[model samples]
Target: MKIIKNILFLVVLLSTLQGFSQEILTKKEALEIALENNFGVKIAKNNLEVAKNNKSIYNTGFLPTASISSGANYSNNNQTIDRQDGTSTSIDGAITQSYNASLNVNYTIFDGLGRKYNYQQLKETYNLTELEAKETIENTYLQLFTNYFQIAKLTKNKENLNEALSISKKRLLRAKYQYEYGQSTKLELLNAEVDVNNDSITLINANQLLSNAKRGLNLVLGIEKEVNYTVETNVDFTNILNFDELHQKMITNNTTLKQNEKNIAISEFNIKVNKSNYLPSLGLSTSYGWNKSQNPATSFLAASSSNGLNAGLSLSWSLFDGGSTKTNIANSKIALENQQILLEQQKITIDNTLKNTWENYQSQLFIINAQNKNVITTQNNFDRSKERFKLGQITSIEFRQAQINLINSKTALNNAKFDAKLTELQLLQLSGDILNVEF
Candidate 1:
């Protein structure tokens, strides 16, 4: 009775430990964690902020620049002077002091509206960064989704292996009993033992794979410490997408396309900026200054003080810069052309990818349905074979074959479901609809 009590206590303790170790990590939770901690997403967000700051008029050269400067200095020196009339004079501890302060302002009065174009360019750059950030976020989401579903797949595979192992164990027990009663040969019992060993090894490997997969997911979640978690095994494939609608969304909302459009706009603005060099630029400059100086020993004018305000206008035109301006404008136009070409190429590539992925997703769904029916059929065969083996109507080898078939069918079904979900996710990503998926 005492031993029984100890065994019960140990069982309860292990159950508690297992419960504490397992965490339920849902897809939403994983994505939320990644959004907050992913390095790529963080960098993209920072880039967006920098672009937003640059979009300001002050950074675009439309605002005047103002600055203030001040300085003070003191010096002591021993001096000797020789007069022109043949008289010599010496002075000791001659002290001098000087102070100066100034405030200056400069504004570009005109530059062929270059500042206006530049400001527009900055705004376009900000828009580009926004798209870039969205792209990064969507990519991250897709990665997490893939990893999460992989875990689910492995989890289901492990369960299938476990079930197979359990069946092998039961067969081993029946073989042992039959041999002890002289109803089975020793060779048959040995074969059952071997099969049990194989199943156990397979299950061990499955467990190891599951552990490694979990560790990979933890890394993606940016968790420095390994966390034990179990994900949901059910794959959802509820999003039914229409091809025409998806294509339209891809054109209007695709991050890469939007970014390319912004780039083209910026390149056009850049050409304008370079062309502005052909016209003269006028600038206004104004300054207020104060100066004071004193000297204890001097031949003439021992001290001086000055204070004034000054203003000036400057104009500049580049008549010949070795054709630099022309080259720059040409390059800008070429860059704009490249952007347009890339946009077209991307549209084609994305369209083809979308069609392929959509077809693949549909095929996966059909495969899953077929595998489901196969699992049911194989499971019935295994059950019947188990009964027949017990009645000596089938050999142990035949029963084992039936069991293996069941396991394989289940594995294929599990894989098919997850693969379909992943393909669907790819479709959404291509359409830029992944960003709309709520965590």
Candidate 2:
């Protein structure tokens, strides 16, 4: 019994420790973890590695290649040969065995500059893959930050709703007391009860929304369902960005722009590579081998039983490919021109995006300020109405109107703040500066 109890205790202790070991993530930490651990990012990084390896393969063309090969054969002869004695000799060999081994080397002394152009093209391709991975990371970070801020905003909104609900409950209690003392009508108490119930429903909905938003954020972070996270709500938005500076940064640092530039370079290299096909290619190959046979008369086997070395240079020219090479070169040039056009379009699009986001951010900032003032004004009106209700100077309907107005104002203010923050984040993202921002 003692042993069983001890084992059970140890099991419970290990379970508790495992439960406690789950990560409690903050917004920054969660974003960092997602960047490092997300499946999408991992796959993108692997693709980039593949591209790099392909570049290495292209680079190997500059180096000499050597390989060793060996083989064995067995045969039964069924023929006759004339010997030096001018007599027919029967070559009745029974199970003759032969073996061969060789080391072959090949080197491209010249190849119409094809290898050089191919290597350059592959390097550009590898760089483009890296840029694509960076673009993926930027997109992921934007999504993570958006969700993070949304959760924080929802939390604040829920807190405000709870406060409003508490106020409603207090008002209900006061109305009930007044009705019992014959100082307030039954209708007044009924209205207060209705307000409390409504606030309670709203609070419940807010709680549900907060829960769903948290789950969504966790999903984005690739965390388990049981994990919990808290967002840092105190984000700074005071750093004013100049439009010109943002545009310059986007042009200089945006991964998409870099990728497009690499595409253009790759297109140019493709044209060169195709043009090189019109020229002749030169190469050298050499081989040395040894062979052995059990029947010396049937195989070329001297006392040394070896084959001599052989080396040669080869040349290959397309000469004429029915205009195929010319067509390829034309297609490559057209592609390069298209890429230039695409680059221009991309620049225009980025500029428009930046301008629109900046304008929206400015508009939201003003709305937030105005909503803040409105909240204060509505709060003051509610306070005055409350005092008047207590002194019997205002009716319950008038007091309730003031309370509803205050709630509406607070909700509007919260929404405006959330929108302002969201727009600011968008601007930062469009400018390619979101990752550099320290939350």
Candidate 3:
């Protein structure tokens, strides 16, 4: 009775674990999960939030700063006064206490529109961060597409190995029957057995590879434990690259290039901000203060209280800073030029990538086409050889060769298909179409 209950408990536990552990997802679903949970995406999102916060009016130094403070102090002292006539008066144990509180406000009235430029720069920074987040999402989708399709390829390979193993088993069975009835030699039967064993080993290795592929996909999804999951058998390869469109869009919409452009804008804004130092800055400051003093030694200073408000308009300009302002403006202009140069350089690099990826994508398509014919021919040969061997018209060695050939051909076709799919994804990624991955 106890054993039965224990078995039931174990079964229930496993059932619950399996239910909780497995997370089946389609490509779209996986992408959605990765966008929400990926560390890169989350970090970029946080940086964007920071940029947004910095673009606020208070952060851009457009609002007045106000503060209040209070203080109290007490002191005990002895004092003496002497006159030129040589008579002196002394006082002992004179104690005094004072208290004061103040409220102050400072606002910049004008600074050559530096605050406006700063605000605009911060807004641009926020937009750049937004693009950065989008880029991260796009890159993440590319990675997911890769890992997802790799599993699909491995799964196909596993199926091929399984079918090969089944054929080997059938051959082994036939060989055993022939040997038992004295219709085949012991050597042929032994060879058949070896083929079955070899096939089994290959199948096992293929299964291990499939398992590893699943584990990698799980890791990409940020899942801690392995789970039962399957991906779409078909990979997307619908869109082909049009170089003219890509080149135009590359300069206009490429996130990295746009980020570079933003950098240049910031540098231009910085020049304006620094030029503001050349002009006198005007500010208004106001304070309301209260003070009271208690003094024992003098009547005028004893128990006096006063309260008043003071306001002032202040002007400050750096007359000279050892030519640092000129140097800063020059550097800002240089930096802007540097960013522009980098944007052009990026275009050159992207041109190379597009051309090469387009070629590779085309090459893989040709390979798939070539391998399709090979697969058909190999399958025909394998079928004919199997029949001939069963009728004792061909040796087991000939049949085995045909079997291996067919397997290789099928495997090559699947590889070519997968390679083409990946290259297609790469093309999409380079053109920033991965951002629109859906359906």
Best candidate according to lDDT: 1
Off by over 4 Å in 2: 1-25, 57-60, 78-95, 227-229, 296-304
| Better-scoring candidate (TM-score), 1 or 3 | 1
Most TM-score-accurate candidate: 1
Candidate 1 lDDT trough over 10 residues, lowest sum: 1-10
Model 1 ranges off by over 4 Å: 1-21, 71-98, 293-304
lDDT of 2 by residue, 1-439 (tens): 3563576467558846854774555766877878877777888999998998999964648998999999998877676767688987565654577799999999988888888899999999999999898878877887887787787787677667766776776687789789889999999999989988998899889877877887877677777655244456655674856888878888888777788999999999999999888889888999998887676464445334668898999999888999999999999999999999999999999889889988888888898889989999999999999899889999888987898888888878877877787777777767667778775
Tens digit per residue, CA lDDT, model 3, 1-439: 3563576467558956865775656787877777777777788889988988888887988899999999999988787868789987777877889999999999999987889888988998888888888888777777877888888898788778878877877787778778889998999889988998998899889778878887877767766645466566775567664777866755667777777888888888988988877888899999999999898763346698889999999988889989998998899889889988988898888878878988888889899989999999999999899889878898889999999999999999999998898888777777777676464
Models sorted by TM-score, best on top: 1, 2, 3
lDDT of 3: 0.82
Candidate 1's residue-wise lDDT over 211-295, tens digit each? 8888888767777645467888877665666888988988888878888889889999999988988899999999999999997
RMSD of each: 3.9, 7.9, 5.9
Candidate 3 Cα misplacement greater than 4 A, ranges? 1-23, 78-92
- Candidate with the larger TM-score of 1 and 2: 1
Model 3 Cα displacement at 50 (Å)? Answer: 2.4
